[model samples]
Target: MNLKKSYIAAIMVAALLLGGVGAYFGVQLAQSQDSTAQQGGNGGTFADLSEEEQQELIGSSQGNEKLAKVNKAFNLIKDSYLEDVEDSKLIEGAIQGMMDSLEDPYSVYMDQETVEEFNHSIESSFEGIGAEVSMVEGKVTVIAPIKDSPAEEAGLKPNDQILKVDGESVEGLDLYDAVSKIRGEQGSKVTLEINRPGVSDPLNIELTRDDIPLETVYSDTKEVNGKTAGIIEITSFSEGTAKRFDEELAKLEDKGIDGLVIDVRGNPGGLFTAVEDILKNFIPKDTPYVQIEDRNGEKSRYFSEIDEKKGYPINVLIDEGSASASEILAGAMKEAGDAELVGTTSFGKGTVQQAIPMGDGSTIKMTLFKWLTPEGNWIHEKGIDPTIEVKQPDYFYTNPLQVEEPLQLNQNNDQVKNAQIMLNGLGYEPGNKDGLYDQKTANAVKSFQSDNNLDSDGKIDEQTANKLQADIVEKIREGNNDKQKEKALEVLFQ
Candidate 1:
């Protein structure tokens, strides 16, 4: 369905959980309490009722034995607990317990503070390291770091499994609790022990939290296969991301680039509306973008309606970090024959969550629906595999770079080409790997150096060259290691 209708549904269902609880126990307790309070003053107890009256009360209360037992436990906790507990806390705890019983990770109860933080994270800036994270394979994994954010600045990469925060193991922590542990006051330092694939030992990295401004769409131009191509990287789908994407596409069209590379590498997805709006730019008018099946087995289809397509050959770059709205966009484009997907499989997250705000400033992010591609494919646990599977370099996990001779900018040799391949594989865009180092190549080298805690002088000295080559060799040793961008360019040029 459309976003407007979905929002209305969310508002209508905001009090569903509490209302259900109130229907079951709240009314009965209130009626019994009011009778006792009026008869025997405010300090009245259920003991005032005779045994027969208590049985009658239970009988009248829906004849549900479970409700009676729950009320018994509530009163017991209130009377015999060592510490006085607020009724609100007890009620919220009940709600949390109920949600936890569902055993669904996406279904959660947000406290007032958490609700506010969640809203702020989507709509505005927040104090954090700025990484999109989720529970992957039962571990808290970094989906992708936001570009230029503290997470990226600290060299955090996608698929990095967070093992500990401040030396505390997060083995049994939920996603929300893990995120809370990582986020703190701005300028505060947080240390993360990460277990990345292909690495034996965990690596500890410290990052300073910052007020991260949320920006989803970024664009630039890159030369591929002797042709200039537009590269639009969408970090995540946020509010107004569609508008931003349209503006960027317009700028790229004005440049008249040969091809377009839409990079949703580490994007963990966001608003459904944002994805719906952005998909219209590339897909044909009225083409089905995504379909959602609700609770009652009712299905709704979202379609694209842009009359004119960009028409440029499009290549979508994805990795394990790409999920949710990223999948929606990529799946739509691929199914519509509008783009060819490059890179590795996307992080599968086919369910849709509706954030319903409660009256008490708390919220419930419930997974209300499951989404499918235009071709009716369910990629929930099973990810969307790339038509061209290009694995990232193994050195990203191996921690060593290999090179023999020092390579500088403007050098034309196979060594420079190898360095370029290694750099691209490591997520550094060092122009084309034609064996000739250009200015973009130097800048990419500097960026890599800065990220790896080395000198950022834009020159590949002996030390830098060795590091780059070591990474390449490690990838080669891992077998079938080549540049993903190279395959992408080949597809676009073909």
Candidate 2:
């Protein structure tokens, strides 16, 4: 992001004023978190109001008629309960119920402990599986895993419902509680029983939690067909991201790259200002890069100060994992900057949320605005479209082959089908993926085993399945066949 003091301040003022929530875009929060624009956060509100204003608001709130029924219930529960209940607990439960009534997963209430954990995860990093999650339909659903984090490394996909953490059911638990269970000491093993969509049985995925790092930008250059393309992968938008992006971009430009590919495939998003700063680099001054709409439908259009677009082609890589600020950037680039987006549809998240602190340590994160693209299109629930839709190889989507019993010839089952998919992805074509363990599939399994230096048996045993999964994961990590990226380069030079 381009963080010129004057420009960043201007944008911050717009966000705070439109947010209409007390300066929850508080200076400390903005400075500390760079005003993260992710889907969730600790509290940032109640930081700017003066003592007099706070007293006035509190005094007025006490006499609010809208809360008459609520107060009556609160008093009844407090006075005539069979068993004693903590006043604080009842009050917090009320707050959480109100948030639940909104029916929006992004809005939530976090207590001090949760707030501190959330803040820690954003500020530096934390020891956990490293995935952004939400309470969707009463289930703790993964929004997306952080790039290169344990959650991603463990094959946790977007929308995977975490049914159990460490063999204990997380059903009926709030998003915070479920996530707390998922997090543990660094290097400790945590097993997640995941209810993946379309799978008949839940899979137990064991992951070793590690310290998730804070760095977001990764840069490299790819030489393809005589043209060098600069590739910048933005894992998330956070403090100093714009500066880092600028520095890396300059280095790429210095090397005389012919084209550029901006990869935000698994980026879950960060601060609004962080993305806004990055937009200024590519989007021309003539068009509004993003438009923020408030509760009353008041719109604030934000534009860059740049005179023109870059000379070389710009291609953005997006997939199901790109969200929020990532979507904001993708929308702006495709519509206003004319950058070609090469990948599948993105994760749709269009609302902007700001956290408001309660007098106590807890805070309420409320969705305050709906952001639209430069073309006045709201991609909430409906993702931004790619100019050239390119899908990765099937291996990228293949799940781990679970082999409880040896999958040998003549066996036909879902497990066998899954194994066939993996074998096919490994280039040992299993002839068909219809769940039939035919002679050809057995041959493929034997070939794969031999290649991995295992016994040349034509059966997919536990060891063979593990080896197959490990090799496929390693190939994916190496990106030996990233079809989407190849398409981006193809479009860049076309």
Candidate 3:
């Protein structure tokens, strides 16, 4: 498939990201949705229905008396409205109105262009900041930043409200329109004004858009207690994820590792069957890994064929950023596999959605089912809590300093206070982070300046502040100081 690499996703998705924005996952979980609109085996690519197909849809739509009133209103608006309006626009608007009435964020109407982008082959690369974002409560909110992407590097966090893109307010813009503004050519810079939770002021995050790779599984080895422990980090589930996971885990097993740790932090999720395949490696056939409930309230359970679990203990890492299919994996590991979960909590998204093509190039991705964990727990809005909760270091959540002016001795303000916090976190140890720059704070600043090869002046300037933030971000990314990761690895053997 010579599909163009999509630039944006719901977060280029898990649609494989609505920028590559947030969780627009593909559904192979329920094959019934794909049973419709079939065209030559590309998984639900049906369009321009035959006579029989059109009749099937119309027969289902017939005998709805309220639709007559809706049709009457549509005609009245078309014939008697004060201004000229295109019929296509009116129809699309009507459909959008219906979607809004449903009040489901994941259930969205995709136009032809968006539909094409949304269905972009999972095997392709992605471009953008690489965070899954959605319109939440009238504001475009970050669902989760893709691992190793520019969005993650720039510190974009889940639930972060994006107020503007490059100074333009996004108050009235829809998600796609806002995503268009956020997406850019690789190497181009985009500035996002973010209104994050618990922050007094909006943050200005500048990122250089880049290509997000298609690879979803990352493997490594951690030596814990003089024993080699395998660590598999699942950034997202995609078409090739399960195979990669299997190959990697087999290699780890070949090495005779004592235990295993699967990390799914900040994973917005991808294809359903992809996660299902991965679960088959851990979840036994005796119990169902996940259960799906349709609109009819009928339940269907899915189980793995494996009769026994792994030889060693296992632990899964999760946080508020871990969502959708990620939740499914974590839930299975916690319940079915009897593995401990480390980290704060999982992102509570237990619904199943499918993008059914409208036969007119457009598509409607609707939430069709509610997914429950193996124990039949519906964790919709309430996320799954970790068995052993752990948080990252304080510096990981430190506020980004927007120091317009230099901070010198005796200056009392937030800028000074923020710099002190950063310096303390970086091991400089400034006396009292009280938003006041004392002589000791100045010394700490001078020490940081000297270490970074800047002028050893006892003042926090623009260059100095930027360097501090960069270094802090680097430290946060290092995982050397990450407490959650430390706990996750330690719990593997304990």
What lDDT tens digits, residue by residue, belong to model 2 across residues 351-433? 77756666566677667767899999999888888989988877777766667788898998887888888788878889999
- Cα error, residue 319 of model 2, in Å, equals 0.4
TM-score (C-alpha, index-matched) for candidate 3:
0.90
Residue-level lDDT of model 3, residues 338-396, one tens digit each, is 89999987778888775655667876666766778889999888889999989876667
* Best of the candidates, TM-score: 3
Candidate 1 per-residue C-alpha lDDT over 1-494 given as tens digits, one digit per residue, 9 for 90 to 100: 00010000001122111101000000011221221122213323232355467456645865677678777878899999999998888878887887777776666777887655554554456678877776665688876666556776566777788999999999987667788898887899999999877555676777898877656677878777788788787766655678999999899889888998888776777666667677767777556777765565555565555676676788988887687778888898798846889998988878765445555677665666677888889898777889889875544433322244457777886556656777987779988877798999999999999987889988777678656755554444343443665577678868
Give the best candidate by lDDT.
3
Off by more than 4 A, model 1:
1-66, 121-123, 136-138, 223-228, 307-309, 399-482
* 10 residues in a row with least lDDT, candidate 3: 36-45
Which pairs of residues have clashing backbones in candidate 2? 1-242, 1-277, 1-278, 2-277, 24-45, 36-271, 37-270, 37-271
| lDDT preference between candidates 2 and 3, better one | 3
Between prediction 1 and prediction 3, the one with superior lDDT is 3
Candidate 1 worst ten-residue window by lDDT: 1-10
